[model samples]
Target: MYCPPAFREEELPALHDLMRAVRLANVVTSGTSGLHASPLPLFLDETDGPYGALYGHLARANEQWKDTPTGEALAIFMGSDAYVTPSWYASKKEHGKVVPTWNYTVVQARGPIEFFEDEGRLRGVVERLTSLHEAGRPEIWSVSDAPEKFIKGQLRGIVGLRLAITSLEGKRKMSQNRSAADRAGVAAGLSASARPGERLAAAEIPQG
Candidate 1:
């Protein structure tokens, strides 16, 4: 999370929104095994802490949950990202100095990681996560949709996660470092591209 001043986003509300919008997060922890990372769909309990608590689950057998973290764990959430080509920068034609880069929104949550097997907590986390992702669907699913015995069995195979987030860092790189002309060129170029991510990035760029 090397956030330059121009790209850094320190607003808490914006960071929370970004984290929530990007459902899946990468949780990284260092342990005796060196480092382990798990891609999990995490839900943020904004009211739980100043920086918000994180909730998720991992396979019961995942050694990541078993090993004690050496220090703070990091949960990474990534939003729309796209490759920015030199051809999209006006500076490229002026001095031929512009190189390719990427535009993206990212949030990193650093905290102490806790893993537990309490069925009640696990059930609550799973149900909330399901509802968050299944909202507005044709047929929303719920934890109770499955048989109670079956649900219990399923829960048995997973472990619950809770992280009292101590720090939240966000960065939004959307051609903010480029000159006005170069930013406009990038927006136009990306807006005309077929890639959905590129188009999203285009709309994020500042337009004069």
Candidate 2:
């Protein structure tokens, strides 16, 4: 990601928080054939390493997993984003130099990729992922809730993936480059927006 210093998020805990808030990630890899990407619901294991590891599953039919990755794979997680109109900037009225831009948060994780078919490991991955997303639900679902034979058959159709993160980068472009007045204006404009994403982004803008 091309992140300016003002937008860069270098704190590990902050990066992990952004990653955990977003459920899906785009896992990209390169092989002899070319580049391939798959959207997967990855679960982060914070204690696995210094940067942490990611676990997810891919369909057995997905060819991306079959080809050997030439280098480290990338996983992208995108958080709340909103379009920022120049009209929201106070400087726009003063100098008419401001242009439209976007406010968003994102994390990119790169690591050596490994794919496995071990049924036990796959089941464990599935169970952990399920629990993560279903934590606050009225009726939480578990792998044991389904028939063992059915889950076993289902597991056969997919493969588990593990990426031991070697590098993690995060960017939070939330009007941090703007002046205090301009940022306040942006927050006010976004907070008044009907779009939920815009409203969420409004809360992320730094007040200072």
Candidate 3:
């Protein structure tokens, strides 16, 4: 991901929090066929690795896993996003030079792609994914909620994936390049909008 200094996100804790809050991620890998991407719910295990590890699964027949990746694959986690209209900038009223843009947070994790179909590993992947999304619900679901035989049979139809993340890049573009008054305008404009993500982005404006 091409990131400029003004919009880059470099904090380790912040990056992990962004990834975890996003809930889902896009895994992209270049192959002989073409650039392929799979969007799936991901869970991270931050035990020992420098950047921890990523875990997820996809349909077994998804050819993304068929050919070994010749190099690093990228996993992208997208955070709160909002459209910033030109009217949100103070420059629009002064010099009238500003144009519409977008503000968002994103994290790109690149690493060696690893594939697994062993039942144990696959089972663990499925369980963690389920728990990550289902937690805090009134009636949380468990992997064991389904019949063991049924889950085993279901697991056979998909492939589990793990990436020992080697490089992690992130960016949070929330009108940081704009003047304080312009950014305040953006926050006020977005806060009044009904879009959930816009409201979220409205709160991320740095105190610059």
Best by lDDT: 2
Model 2 CA deviation exceeding 4 Å by range: none
Clashes of each: 0, 0, 0
User: On residues 19-120, what C-alpha lDDT tens digit does candidate 2 reach at each position?
Assistant: 999989999999878898999999999999999999999999999999866469999999999999999899988999999999999999999999999999
**lDDT by residue for model 3 over 41-84, one digit each (tens)?**
88888873999889899999899999656578899999999999
| Stretches of model 1 off by over 4 angstroms after superposition | 69-71
| Selected candidate, larger TM-score, 2 vs 3 | 2
Which number leads on TM-score? 2
36, model 2: CA deviation in Å? 0.6
lDDT of 3: 0.89
lDDT score for residue 28 of model 2: 95
Candidate closer to the true structure by lDDT (higher is better), 1 or 3: 1
lDDT (Cα, tens digit) per residue for candidate 1, span 1-208: 6889999999999999999989789999988878899999999999998989999999998999888554689999999888888997888888999889999999999999898899998999999999999999999899888999999999999999998899999999998988999999989998998988789878989877
Considering lDDT, which of the candidate structures 1 and 2 is the better prediction for this target? 2
